[model samples]
Target: MTISAAFSNALSGLTASGRASGVISDNIANALTPGYAKRSLELTSNATAGQGVRVLGVVRRTDPVLTDNRRSAEAMSLNADNLARFHADFGALIGPSDNPGSLTNRVAELEASLITAASNPSAPSRLDATVNAASDLAQSIRSAGTGLRDLRTRADRTIGQQIDNLNGTLQDIEALNARIRRVQLSGADTASLLDQRQQLVDQVNTIIPVKIAARDHSGIALYSEGGAILLDGSAATLSFTTAASAEPHMTQANGLLSGLEINGMAIRTEGGASPIRGGTLAANFQIRDELAVEAQQNLDALARDLIDRFADPAVDPTLAAADPGLFTDAGAAFLPADEVGLSNRLELNAAVDPSQGGNSWRLRDGLNAAGPGAQGDAALLKAMSAALTDPRALASGNLGTGVMTAGGAATAMLSITSQASAETEQRASFAAATFTEFQRIEQEIGVDTDAELQSLMQIEQAYAANARVLEVVGTLMDTLLRI
Candidate 1:
């Protein structure tokens, strides 16, 4: 080759090597960075002019299929994680059936107290103990109901926060899309912009399951899996209304609960038909509207069963036909329509509850009797004990339509709690396993520092070779001119 031509080739080679080294350094530096894609310098051989190399641009190494799979896996993992946490929290509130302070254990204590009171109907201390046990049982149900409502309220608040975050992310993605298009049109490096966009997309995926579509001018459009447009040329708006507090009677069917809205359209927040399933937001809604609500209903049913058991006319004939029984709905007969909040409103009958200034001797007499009956009359106490152990149908649909004793009803409620706890543990284990697998796959596709270092070594050799060629060319030119 001519000296001039040799000089031109050496210069091109040196420039290409320098660019490659820079790209390699970037890869090594971002090896541990989340969402960072490894980059490589694209080069082409210039055969026409015999130039050593021509830099095309930087290419970001990524597997579109793997990335899509990871996004989907992450969404599912988050959904499971939220659900598991809800179940665990609920279980902690109710405690295990065998625990001394559990609902069933409290019921058992009351039943045992009633038997002891029946054996010594004239003993004021025994009667007082029975009343205390009954009060304790009522308070346990009320506390559990309150705890469940609080969980629902918190879930509602979290849903609102997630909606706000989702809206913000969508807006950011829309702005990034415009910038990316402008950079592409100007023929400038869009790698940084693309990275930012990917990070935003990942955030969006954690909130809700979405489908991404390529748009013109290097832009992307986001849509819900159910076909709601989240973003196109502009970001779509999302909104939610949060309730100050949740109550057992407040439900979606009654329009007392909040639901999600997207771009002025209402959307289902739960079930298979829900538009935002397979994400953390969906899990929160399901906990609030479905799981927590169901638990509250079960507790209310247990309370209703307890009230009804003592309220039976046969158990307390001394009470007027319309008088409140041993256990009443806030000092009155429980109306079937009021079963929704029975747990929260359950209270011991004032006639037997000393805290309500009633006589303890009333346990042996009729609740409505003007004064204490025979001191040794054990008829009412025996009947009350039998009433507690009597087999009867429970009001809870969750426990199925089966006849069971008071203790059996408590056992059924505990069974429900145990089942939920077990399911939560299983789901958590599965989610952890899924997340670990996805992380492994992601790591496989991430930057390899060792590979980048080896590439840098190769680039250094090429740069040194090119520099030597230039040095030799310079010496030849000097020699020629000197001659």
Candidate 2:
């Protein structure tokens, strides 16, 4: 080649090397960023007409499929977390406690008091002891209900705060979208803007899984799997509102103006429907609605059942009044009016009070051995014991008849709660394990300082070679001039 051509070729090589150095610098700088896939500069020779090289663009090596899969796994993990927490709280009520004041211990104390009352059926102090035992049981149920309600309140507050943060972050994302679009239109370097955008996207993914796509004017669009448009360039935005204390659900929607819609339904700032599906939002919502509410409801049901069952007096075979029921009044429903079937289906118990006056020996089938036999108070106590033993008597929402026979209703409630608690703990353990694995994998794919340092070494050698070429060319030119 001619001297001029040779010099031109070397100059192109220098430019290519400079671009490569820039890529290496970028890689080294972001070596610690999580989920940051490695980036490489694409180079192509411009050998058609003249000799030169072109920087095609910066490309990131990432597995989109893996990214999507990880997001899904994260959603499941969060759900499991909520379930686990629910079970833990419920477990506290049912599971044995180290404290002497635990609910199970209190129930056992109540049972002991009952046995004492049976032994001294005519003593006022023994009857009072039974009453005291029932009172203690009520107190235990109340305490459990209180804890559950408190948890619900805390969860609601957290959800509110998180939603506020989500809104703020979304607005920021919208602003960044504007900036990215502007840079793209101007043909300026938008890599940094893109990096910022990805950061926001990643943050949002932890809160809720989303689908991202390119939008008009070099902008991006974020969508829910359910077709909810969360963000789109500068054209759209999503919003949500927490409910008033009385309302059962919160509202949510999408779009900047003309109101927003969640799942195609319009929502307002007033109480709206829930907007959660597989993310932190879903997890928090489950804690607030399912776990917390159910625990409160169950405890409340037990309280009311106790009160109603003990309100009446039991009569003898001769229809003479004998043993009185344990409670005088039942508590109100814990659920809201909108909760369908919550009132009738969620009642405590009707057969609890044995006092229709005896001969009242109207033996209820499960209680009376001879079927309406005249054993009177004796039969009633036996029935109570039988009722307690049947596990199916405990009312769980609308599920089954409450396990309220006298045999072991309290223990049954405790057992169910214990199982739920164990389930929650197990789920939490699994989520923690998966999260650790995710971190490990992320580290593998993300920045590694040693590896980046090695890359820098290669870049340094290339830069030196380019500089040497320039130096050699300069020396050769000087020699020619001297001739």
The top-ranked prediction according to lDDT is 1
Count clashing residue pairs per candidate: 0, 35
Misplaced by over 4 Å in model 1 are: none
Question: Looking at candidate 1, what is the lDDT of residue 308?
Answer: 79
Candidate 2, residues 1-483: lDDT per residue as tens digits?
766666776777777777777877787887776545677878788766476577777767666666666666676677677667767765675446555566666666656655655454445455455445555555566556556655665666666666666667777888988887788788776767777767777777777667878777657777754455677654243444444331212212222112234435653321123344666766666666566556555554554444334333332222213222433233232333333213222322223222222221222222222454332234444434333333445434422363444324555566777777777778778877886776567667765668777877886786677677778888889999999
Q: Candidate 1: lDDT over CA atoms?
A: 0.85
* Model 2 spans with C-alpha error above 4 angstroms: 93-99, 117-135, 233-275, 315-407, 424-443
In model 1, what is the error at residue 446, expressed in angstroms?
1.6
| Model 2 / residue 429 / CA error / Å | 4.4
lDDT of 1 at 420: 78
What C-alpha lDDT, on a 0 to 100 scale, does residue 48 get in candidate 2? Answer: 69
Q: Where is the poorest 10-residue window by lDDT in model 1?
A: 318-327
TM-score per prediction, in order, is 0.95, 0.73
Give the Å error, residue 76, model 2: 2.2
